[model samples]
Target: TKQLNFLLPDSDATVAFGKRLAPALKQGAVIYLYGDLGAGKTTFSRGVVQGLGHNGNVKSPTYTLVESYQFSEQSVFHFDLYRLADPEELEFMGVRDYFADNNVSLIEWPQRGEGFLPEADLTVSLAYEGEARQLTMTAKNVRGIAILAALKS
Candidate 1:
């Protein structure tokens, strides 16, 4: 596993980090976002989606569960499982199908869908640090390692 840690001074810094992160990812990348409410997980994801070529609005799918953006080469799926009462709820939603090739899944509250969700390529944990935010990213597979290494360079 590979890990990278950084401090984001503000929302803009987090967005910048996410924009920089977008290039290192590709299709089938599953990124689990862990953070408390208002910790900027959605803000980071918005940056990633916009950086990946989505021109429309990017908002937390808190009530919708998932929101998808279609791109020429890749599709980005944002999921918020905070409202989920059971992991099995994902199975009924055909969660597996959403992770198909050419798809990038950014899952928030991933713990809520543990058993149904596939292993994440990367895990991003955010914490409040003063008025800023701290990001701790873990690469779980070869693909994730490449991403972290690329970001390092």
Candidate 2:
């Protein structure tokens, strides 16, 4: 998969990108988010959830690990593996259940859960560059490619 580079001038731009990305999401899609703490992962997720018609407070699953949302049209599971002690804990927590039919999974710190987590359709890496942020999005599969295409148009 090739990487698509995007420049986010500020936190608002990152959030806007997520909002635009939400409508392109499909069932069974997995999105892996890579970034450092305070890099706006939660902010982006909030926009995505809002774009998906979820009008509530969106918080990081730092303690809970995963937050599952059941909407009228789709189900979304947001996972934050920052607090994970081991990838094996995922199985014990029944992480597979979240990947069931018609669900879209958004994962943060996926590297911590490497072997336990499923392959991501899309992988977005965010990094701070000066006063701006750099977002590199890569599509690992056809579904993700379609999402990139949609985002472009």
Candidate 3:
């Protein structure tokens, strides 16, 4: 329920934050990414995947809407809803299935799929502050708060 704010000096700092967060993640966790266009959502997701032991390229699922990765220990789903015409489209895409007990989901523009997506454990909001970024991590559940604590430590 507490919000933690971190001043990221650059895009690299944001990526580093994501890298620090990835190893602490567990299955069934949901991360909501909120920001305007070109806010480094995809860049952060790349760091997350790399930190999770993934050695492949990470790209935004803008047109496709969702990108899935199957790891040795867990699965990660990246969702970009900017192209979504309606929230109901999530139902047709079986969005609920991605939030099951075995997966961790990172969603961008979550407002597009409000009711269809599961509640986020963590919400990371990125804003451009001059040339740098200000990142605010808000915990919506116990798991998220734990992760934030770990990041702080």
Candidate 4:
């Protein structure tokens, strides 16, 4: 797997990076976001949603489990599974439908989804580094390798 590391000095920098990452996404891209509470996962996701042309707020789906945003070209699904009690609940919610070819899935607390979720093309992990944040992105497949390459370039 190919990996990239970034030092985000603040929330703005994290969002900026997410914006930069957005254009590299191919249709049906699945990205897993791994981070602790207050690690800026939602802020980064907001950047991705905005980068994909969503004009409104990109709030976390912590309670809702998933929020869908539609664009002319594709649909983006932002999923926060932090509050989920069982992974099987995803099946009941028609989670597989969210991974359709025309959609991009951004999942937080992906581990909670476990067997219910498809393999992520890319995984992004965020951690605290003093008052700043450190982000590590790993490519898990061909598509992820391409996206990471674009980000590097």
Candidate 5:
């Protein structure tokens, strides 16, 4: 497994880090985002969607559950499962369809969807650190390892 850490001094820094990870996702990936409320998960996701060619605003799918952005080569699905009442709800909503091999899926509050979601290729955790945030990325498979490797360079 590969692991990378970053100290983000602010929201912009977190978003910048997301942008750095964007290029490595051209082949698509499943990224699980772990963090408490206000930890910048949505902000980071916004950066990724934008980096992939989204020109409009990227809002959290807290109430809607998921939002999708389309680029020329790939699609990005941003999911916020904080409001999920049961994992089965994911199945009811056809959530599995969102994680296509050719698209990127960024899931926030993934623990809420537990068994219903696919295995993540990468996992990202963010935590509050003084006036900043600490971000950690862990590679769960070969695809993730390649992403981290790309970021290292």
Candidate 6:
């Protein structure tokens, strides 16, 4: 699988990178966001949702757990499992239903749902590199490979 790694100097740059990556997000794609506190995961997601034709706001689902944005042709599900107490809560909430063929899921803190979460097509890890952010993306499946390829260019 192909891997793409780079640096974004600020939140604007991070969002710009996410915007560039948005087009490769096909239906049923599961993207995992890995980052610590204060990282730019939510900012990146906002760029993606906006790029996907959502004219409204994109907020973090930290307290709400999940947030959905509906578009004419597709739906985007942004999940923040940061506060999840147990992974089984995902099953209890019927998370599998969210993975439908026409839906796109961008998951933050996916580690919190570990065993209950579906396999991720792409994994994005963000870390601090001095004053900037270092981003590394790995492809876990064919769809992710295509997405990573898009980032490579």
Model 2: pairs clashing at backbone N, Cα or C within 3 Å? none
- Write down the lDDT that model 4 would get: 0.91
TM-score of each: 0.95, 0.94, 0.94, 0.96, 0.97, 0.93
Model 5 segments more than 4 A misplaced? none
Per-residue lDDT of model 5, residues 27-99, tens digit only: 9999999998999999999889988878899988999999998888888999999999998999999878888
Candidate 4 lDDT trough over 10 residues, lowest sum:
20-29
Give the per-residue lDDT digits (tens) of candidate 6, residues 1-153: 468888999999988888888777755589999998878889888888888888788889989899998877788899999999998999998888888886789999999999998899988899998779999999998888887776666
Give per-residue CA lDDT, model 1, range 1-153, as digits (tens): 399899999999998898888888764589999999999999999999988878788988999999999888888889999999999999998878888876899999999998899899999999999889999999999888988987888
* Candidate that scores best on TM-score: 5
Q: Tell me, what's the RMSD of every candidate? A: 1.2, 1.4, 1.3, 1.1, 0.9, 1.4
Query: What is the total number of backbone clashes in candidate 4?
Result: 0
Name the lDDT value of residue 132 in candidate 6.
Answer: 95
Those runs of model 6 whose alpha carbons end farther than 4 Å from true positions after fitting are none
Q: Which clashing pairs does model 3 show?
A: none
Summarize candidate 4's per-residue lDDT along 1-153 as a digit string, tens digits.
399999999999998998999888755589999999999899999999998888888888989999999888888999999999999999999988889885899999999989999999999999999879999999999888988988888
Whichever of 3 and 4 has more lDDT, that candidate is 4
Clashing pairs in 5: none
The top-ranked prediction according to lDDT is 5
Q: Which stretches of candidate 3 lie over 4 Å from their true place?
A: none
lDDT of 3: 0.86
Task: Spell out the clash pairs found in candidate 4.
Answer: none
Full-model lDDT, candidate 5: 0.91
What would the per-residue lDDT of candidate 3 be over residues 42-143, giving only the tens digit for each residue? Answer: 888888878887887888899999999988778999999999999999999887777878578999999999889888899989898987878888999888
Candidate 2 structure quality by residue, lDDT tens digits, 44-73:
887788778788888889999999888887
- Candidate 6 local lDDT, residue 19: 82
TM-score, candidate 2, is 0.94
